[model samples]
Target: MALKRKKAYESNIEKINGARMTIETQMMAIENANVNLETMGAMRAGAEAMKNIHGSMNIDKVDETMDDIRDQMDIANEISEAISRPVGVGDDLDEDELLNELEELEQEELDAKMLETPSPVVTAPNVPVHVPAARANEVEDDEEAELRALQASMAM
Candidate 1:
């Protein structure tokens, strides 16, 4: 009697395992169907939107509008180029003449400044009054200071 009861329990376990496998397979099928329905809905919505857009558009009018835009853009570019070009910048003109005149003016100003600088006065004995060494921060002239600096550097 105990051996028969053990065999019955073993058969019941096998049947339960088969039922669990069937339920798992059914769940997988339901999940796949849900994914397929969502994909089809999305595809249908996209198709409907595209159909509405196509119904509203005329291809010939679109082409004409694009051509007009391109023509306007071309005209605008031409106008921009014309406006940006420098006026009177002819190949016959010498641009260096203006630079040369500026340089000459600078040289003239330098000469005038040099002529304006006063020379130190000398007494009848021709003795030079010396500046104190401690008060020697005053520059007599930039050219003389530069000359002394050059000489000192060359000596070194």
Candidate 2:
């Protein structure tokens, strides 16, 4: 009876482990699907932007926009590939490595975006700018006059 009980217990453990693996695989599949959908969305947006540019719109900004879309596609591709591979399938395929690569890709995309958007040159305001010494002298004269008046009032 004890032998039968032990066999049943071991079988249940195996079943639980199998279920866990299946769940993990399904989650990965869902993640891949989401990434693909996002890629499609990015591609659609890029196409629409291109169409607008073709319709006589000044599309100087379209290059950067397209590059951004391309970056998104790259990310989607990376994610899909990562998820499609079975977990722990390769010696170099750890979760940390995958996450680090994704982070690096994201940072690269940010850097590209920063490079694409030119900073607006801020010109100084045209207001009458006075030298600081001149302003300070004016303030000092006012303070002296105020002090003299106070002294005179106290004397009275």
Winning model by TM-score:
1
lDDT of 1 at 33: 100
lDDT of 2 by residue, 2-119 (tens): 9999999999999999999999999999999999999999999999998997887456768778889999999999999998988776857688989999999999999999999999
- Give the 10-residue window scoring lowest on summed lDDT in candidate 2: 55-64
Where is model 1 poorest over a 10-residue stretch in terms of lDDT?
Answer: 133-142
- Which stretches in model 1 have alpha-carbon errors above 4 Å? 86-156
| Model 1 global lDDT (CA atoms, 0 to 1) | 0.90
Model 2 residue runs over 4 Å out of place are 57-156
Query: For model 1, how does the per-residue alpha-carbon lDDT over 37-142 read when each residue is reduced to its tens digit?
Result: 9999999999999999988789998999999999999999999988887886664667798789899999999999999999999667666778676446555566
What lDDT does each candidate get?
0.90, 0.93
By TM-score, how accurate is candidate 2?
Answer: 0.35
Clashing pairs in 1: none
- Global fold similarity of model 1 (TM-score): 0.50
